[model samples]
Target: MTLRLSVISASVLLALTTHSIAFADDSAFEVIEVTGHHEGSYSSVSTDSSTPQVDISGLLEQLPGAAVNGNGPLTGIAQYRGLYGDRVNTQVNGVTLASAGPNAMDTPLSYASLVNSERLEMTRGIAPVSAGTDTIGGSVKVIESQASFDEISGKVAAQYQDNGQRSHLGAKTNIANQDHALLVYGDLLKGSENTTSGSGNEIAPTTYDKNIFGGQYRFNLGDSGNESIAIGYQHLETTEAGTPALPMDIDFIRSDRVKLEGIHALSSWELNWHLAYSDAKHGMDNFSQRMKMPSMNARYNNADSASFDGAISVGKDTWLFGIDSQLSQHNSVISDPTMAMFNVDNFNDVQDDTYSAFAQWQQDINQWNWQLGARVKHYMTDAGEVSHSMAEMMPAIKMLMTQFNNADRTQSQTGVDLVLNGRYQVNSELSWIFGLARKQASASYQQRYLWVPMQSTGGLADGRTYVGQMDLELETAYQLELGADFSSDKLTISPRVFLHRIDDYIQGVPATDPAVKMAAMMMGDDNPMQFANVDAELFGMDLAAAYQLNDSWSLDMNASYVSGERRDIEDNLYRISPPKVILGVNYKSNNWLARVEGLGVSAQDKVSKTQFEQRTAGYGLMNISVAYDADSWMLKAGVNNLFDTEYEDHLAGYNRVMGGDLSPGERMPGTGMNAWLSGEYRF
Candidate 1:
């Protein structure tokens, strides 16, 4: 059986040699969200948090129309509101991960591991249709460090930061009674090289190294146990990381994951299921972690991907039904290793699959509270048959590789989605909500198997160089949302507004294939681009608030704004993320706590002249923190940009490596002034 499943996946990744921190009992949670509409958790990192930063969507971007494009230091990428990347939808426990380079640099929440997470949330606004199947830039979830039922327990943590002397360590262990449980974890992070609070230098390769291990097993089945099961395994390791807006960096990324879940209590519809599998092997170079290029512009790459996912659902009371699927495969290769006849074949045997079925309904009547959904999807794609240097180059890449290896690359499609939501409870502190949807997506095999013109496009880090388009179709969207939520007793609030009207909105135009713009102007790109399907529109608004001026002070705020455009011309919508705001002030006692925060932004000249995208200026920063606790132990301290401010974070990208202090297209500077501390203990 494949060597006993590879020796139980290498003994659960060498017994969770990465991260873990679940002391598991300090619990008390109560959420009644509507913040942006269905869920919008946005806070939770507990492990005696102190932030040596480990990008889990940049720590959920402190939530409010979240954002984070950042192309390095673990490859962030997760944007909402005005969409982003593969239009967001990142999950972990419920699987749906897929991303092995292709420019993403192994993103997919970089295989989440934030202080031994146990449910990282975000679902804000219209993610219905059972929350799967291409969630138009929305939905984020993660779960780890679970399996409890009595518990043997454990915990450990560490963190340190001094502008890029960063270091972190984590630990976790567990065992349970009441029907079995087991868990494990590990983490280690390292960094060096990072300076720039308006230019203090450093920046050669914003260094990093990472690792995260995992384990899980849960049990109980039948004999009136009503059934239950859980099994998981994980391993992620990244090395020599540094992605100066990517052109190559990170000489390694190895990922392996497996999952299985179940629940049954038949007799009355109540069975759920899950299955997952993943594998990734990535390698990149441009001279291993920055600098050195020329020796025929040395470069190297090797990307691989494999994914499988399954889902099942069944509900009892208010009706629910489901079926979900996602399967993927990819391959990439490139070379120049001192020109061994210079290779290529960027992608081959690519495949993409998705299958879905959904039905949902919820109710509450009386002051209203409905929900309805419907979904149907099926998409399949294929590719294979490609060559390069095994055949050599030039001649407009031999007329686009002989017209894409003689066409007919197979395809299939069928999509449909619908949703409607509502809420109203007008009184006892008000409430109201609304949502509508229609979504569809397809075409990603690097937008249909890239036939040349590089920059791979999956990460769309905007260093533009695209090429891929073969009768593309299926890209629909039509959404709307409106919101309100208010609560008294220490005040609370939420506000939202949204709109979208898209149609075949894939973007990146202007190539007009003259042999793909003469092979992208012979590789110097004088304006090249492809992957059509246009017409777009987006609108936005956001707000989240809190206050509790008594009982040891409190106050909070979050704001957002979005705008996209291109109703077939007149541009805008390449990186969307302009207005933003955040504020905080807190204090507590009887164990100590403190906070001070602020962040502001607003300057994005709505660029994107067909992916020329660039324009950002506007900044603000301030942060502070403190914590205590004790009982089992805890401590934390923080200082982030507490006046080291030097700005530039318009979704940090650009500056494709080149001996650095940033100059190659600038943008990509933010982070300086750092001071962190963390500690934890429990047993």
Candidate 2:
């Protein structure tokens, strides 16, 4: 039977290579480096791989103004130093997860799944306000994995690559009777993919699936050690594995979540509380194809979403305070492809709502240290469309169209956000940091669904309706950050610099003139949408260092650089930051571990052609990994793109009728040498 299951998977990876962690006498299980900051003197990097699809988003497209649009097995809506869409913001454990194509090339926890994370936080720019509200290009968090005492844990994993193969299994349990505590966990996964492009051509072969479940409970009211209460529940489902000539097709996605928390202590302050709720459902199937039309275009859609959050906290002198709230709702439907022809029908509907409230503070006033915040938000939208074409046909198609209607439009917004931060202590090694922030932007649902496609050849254009301009304001931003961090006794340096500004920066222009481009399409209100208040800028600089040369060795490095543009036609506005430099090297003992990494990018040449249909050209990459550990089971193995080079990223998208390049573009496509093995067991 396949050689007794390959000798029981090599004796269970030689008994987890001999035990997961021991660290030569350091307990509390070392290895915890989590730090991320935005604003208040932003400059962050506290390693354990700066997450982006489980690790550095494929070496950050080899720096130098990075770019990656699409290619294969993609997940990781990347953008760093140059930002993208909705000003980048992602959260988990602090809520916020909603996105299923409204186009930013998809990202909202990227189809969820990161091997049961227990820490992953990233903040780029103009952040801080206690990490909530429209972040101006930054914020990513995921923290999951809980259970302690009477521990009962489990994991099973599998992998294969050349474009597909993955399997996973999980289990967790923790219970303590005597003070009341309970915890439970579950996981299941599946994956498949096939891709090859960027001058190798093979495109399309995808399959991904996942399911997860969770539970947690806690209680304690004695021991004068204060008090505690916690409750949680989670459920998730995912699906989508069909691609090639895409026009949309995804028919499964579900989520359900609940949470509650509390803590207490008196005699001089200490209190905390939180609440959460979530519900999601998404489905899709839509296609389009033309160019010698023989008819073939389908449609079907669905979306249902919900969200809520609440929080409170307190403390003083040296400070710590909080108050926050959030709410979200979505409902959508689309079904109109000539209603499967013959006795036609059509449909479209939409609704969206959002709300927010905030207050926060964090402080220290000796060598200087601070944080402050504020926020307010409210938004709403409603949409509708209908058509019942050709009832019982003929009779000149029911007298040239007997049914058509549209009515039901609404949009609303209310916004506010502010923050300030500071730090100092320019001695004993070094320290200095600064921050300032502001975010304002509201009303979005694809700019209120605006479509205009009719460049001749069997038309369907002349649909111009967008009621939102209701003095549509908000969409303002301001940012400033300065940095300094130094250490000695085995190195640890840091450097940071940033500047950002945006005002009425909601862009989209082109209302073609000359009789609306000879009446080719988009009429009403002279279509050619508008939302302006332009003048944007971004500045960047980042440098990091790490060193430790004893007891097992260590070394690390970092680099970053950015320019400007959000508008003012900065000559096709380049800078979507990604390159400047980044490098690394590592080696360890006590069960062996090794690593080598490099990435570099430059040569953009002031791009054009819509920035080369989403920039590219500038690459360098190399990666290597080695793993081992032993005792009570735990083992790992690795080999990834040791040199298969070919790159692009920035959630690539653009294919002006297939000549703009970037759709099905090249990204994370350097996997010619790949390998992985994992094993674990504990009792």
In order, what is each prediction's RMSD in angstroms?
23.3, 24.5
Angstrom error at residue 172, model 2: 49
Off by over 4 Å in 2: 1-72, 78-339, 342-408, 412-414, 432-443, 446-486, 493-545, 550-553, 556-623, 626-673, 676-683
| C-alpha lDDT of candidate 1 relative to the true structure | 0.75
Q: Which candidate leads the pack in TM-score?
A: 1
Model 1 Cα lDDT, one tens digit per residue, 1-683: 23323332332232233211111121111111233333222333332332456655666666668778888778888888878767777887678968788888878887887667754566777787777788877677765567765579888877788777878788888888878888888888888666455457566576778888998888977545558798889899888888788777878899888898889977888989988888888988878667784632787888889889989998888888989899889898898887798788889878888898998888789997788888899998888988778344478888788889899888898989888888788987887888888888887888778988888887767787888886799889999998877666766666678998989888778788787788777778877788888889888777665666667666566667788888977888788877776666667667776777767776777878878788887677888877787788878787887888787887877788776667877887777778888777878
TM-score for candidate 1: 0.34
Model 2, range 1-683, lDDT digits (tens) per residue? 23323332332232233211112121111122213332343322221222123222332343222233232243444455666545566666666655544332134554344445554445534567666666766665555654443344544433334434555556556766546677777666665544443344333344566676887777776564257777878887767733322344345667787888877875577777778887777664533311112353355556566767777766544445566555555554555556654322212344555566666676667887677778777777664542333334333223212221232356777777787877677777777778787777664555543322111100001112222232346677788888766665656655567887777665444444333232323221344333334567777665555556555655554556566565666543333543444455556767666656655555343432222324545565665655554555555555455555555432333221122223332332233434444454544
Q: After superposition, how far is residue 656 of candidate 2 from its true place, in Å?
A: 29
Worst 10 residues of 1 by lDDT: 20-29
